[model samples]
Target: MILVEGIGPLATIQDLGRPGWFDSGVGVAGAADCGSLRLANRLVGNPEGAAAIEVLLGGLVLRALRHHTMAVTGAPAPATVDGMPVGAASLLELEAGQTLRLGLAETGLRSYVAVRGGIDVAPVLGSRSRDTMSGIGPEPLRPGDRLPIGPVPPAIPIVDVAPVATSTDEILTVRALLGPRDDWFTDATALFDGEWAVSTDIDRIGARLDRRSGPPLERRIRDELRTEGMALGSIQVPPSGQPVVFLADHPITGGYPVIGVVVDADVDAVAQARPGRIVRFRPAG
Candidate 1:
């Protein structure tokens, strides 16, 4: 078991996600930076999709109730166990009663912590992920919470340390495929010419981009769009002309037209982009 001593602004339990339920109005809510979560679990000898803690901007502290192996990944944050420094993406052993601390992220926006056996939380809708937008699954973790650790697997972790990407770039280049509704816009391809800034209004639901370069995207048609299924990284351009990139907790159905869809390979970078960071789009073949 692990005791939460102090938690950061937003900390929640997440796995790969609850898939195949979109038709029932359930969005796929999981770790915003899934690549980081997978890496952390791999370091601890757990399944890639195992439930783990997603820490936002770090500043998290926890105490181990029993000896356990753990790993931290994602954003470049300073971590320490009982006053000793530990590197991200490296396996570390925690003795019972030892306190583990994570400092604020130096670059990216999210961090992931994974224990050897994963967090043994009760699954909801076949997932342990907390959907902040839909109010589904586990509640946000808080102080005094006692998280049970699942039984460890017999297999041992082969790697001691692994290198993971951390966002430190001022401008992020994301590859996107042109649309399910590109015809709705007058100049859908023009969106690639100007740079958009990441807005402060970002969450698991979506990332709103600031149209700093020029006017909002011009629509060729003024008719209301029928509600359609949305996917992660779907770039929906609303009436305001500003583009909103759907994330893990985005609505299952949206009325706005999606001009483009960011490739799955680049979604992790979108999760790490900070507010005011410049974002440029490229056509994905």
Candidate 2:
């Protein structure tokens, strides 16, 4: 068992996510950065989709009730065990009664911690992921919460440390395919030409973007469109013209027109982006 000592801004248990629930009005709410979560799980010898703790902007502290193998990944949060510093993306051995604390993330917006055995939380919709938008799954972790660990898996971890990009100030470029409503825009190329800054209004649902200069995307068709299905990474443009890139907990459908869709691989980078980070779009080949 692991005891939650401190919960910083937000912390939640997550797995790969509950898929196939969109038709039922449920969004697949997993780790915002699924690749980082998978990497943490791999370091702990757990399945890639095993349940783990997703820490937002770090500051999560956990105490082990028993011996456990653990790993921290993503965001490069400073970690320590009983006051001794530990490295991220590497295996950590925690003895009984030992405490692990994670400081504020040096870069990126979220960090992940995985134990040898996944967090044994009750599953809702066949997943342990917490959907902040729908109030589904377990509640956000709080201080003094005791989390049970699952039985250890047979697979053994081979790598001591895994290589991962920490974070960078370089403007992030994401590829998108102009889409179903591209014709509605006065100039679809505007999305690719203009530079955008990530807005402060980011969450598990989506990250809003504001153009650095020039007018936002203008609509040629002022007519109200019927609500349509929305997918992860769907770049929806509202009447205000600013684009919002849907994330893990995005709504199943939206009324706003989708100008384009970011590719899946690049969505991970989008999730890690912090407020004020510059982002540029490029046409997907």
Candidate 3:
């Protein structure tokens, strides 16, 4: 079995996510950088739905009680096992009782730690992810929280993790299809045609964009009409005309007018976005 001994900062159990629970008002709480998590799972030969650790900001320290294969992905952070400096996007063969420590993240906000058979956590609502919004499963990892790792499935495949190339481009393009309420923002064609800066107000709930020009929208949707379902990347604009792009932790229902929905492929980039980052919306059509 795998073991996590010394954990620091915000560490939480995550899997692919609690999908299909949106109808019941549950947010899909999973790895913020899901793409990286998937890769780490593939590296360790675990199924895509395997549970792992989602390290926020960064500062997680742990150890393996038994031999296991692990991988670290998402963001550039220095991780080490027993001070040997074994980290990055590669499969690691951790020996029994080896100490694993994750240092501060250098470039990104969240990182993922994937184990061979995934973390041994009971499923709630058909998933292994923790819903911080709903207080589902265990709460975020606190100091001295003894993490339980599942039994290692017999064999782990060998994987090669090449050094990841980081991007520094100012323009972050996200594919979007227009309108659940396109008519509301008729004057703001620039929402699709213009460049927007990632507002400093961005967070797990949503990422707001700095508006260049648009008339303030009236939150006209009646209370009766506010229970509409939301797709993952729906870009909703409230009375402020400031767009709050929904993230994994967003509520299932919202009162604002959704002007567009971001494309699936670019969702990971949206997940990794930091405040002050510049992003431009592109029409998928």
Give per-model TM-scores: 0.97, 0.98, 0.89
lDDT of 1 by residue, 1-285 (tens): 999988889899999999988768898899998999999998989999999999989988989999999999998889999989988899989999999899998887899999999999999989999999889999899999999999997769999999765445788999999999999998898779888999998988889998767545899999999999888999999888889999888898899999999999999889888899899999997
lDDT of 3 by residue, 74-124 (tens): 876798888988758888888888877888887667788888888887888
- Local distance difference test, each candidate: 0.91, 0.93, 0.76
TM-score of 1: 0.97
Which model, 1 or 3, shows the larger TM-score? 1
* Residue lDDT tens for model 2, 1-285: 999999899999999899998879998889999999999999999999999999999999999999999999978899999999998899999999999999998778999999999999999999999999999999999998999999999999999999877545579999999988999999988999869999999999999999996556989999999999998999999988889999998999999999999999999899999999999999998
Off by over 4 Å in 3: 1-8, 162-165, 212-225
Note the residue pairs that clash in candidate 3. Answer: 6-61
Candidate 2 CA-lDDT value:
0.93
- In terms of TM-score, the best-performing candidate is 2
**Residue 29, candidate 3: C-alpha displacement in angstroms:** 2.7
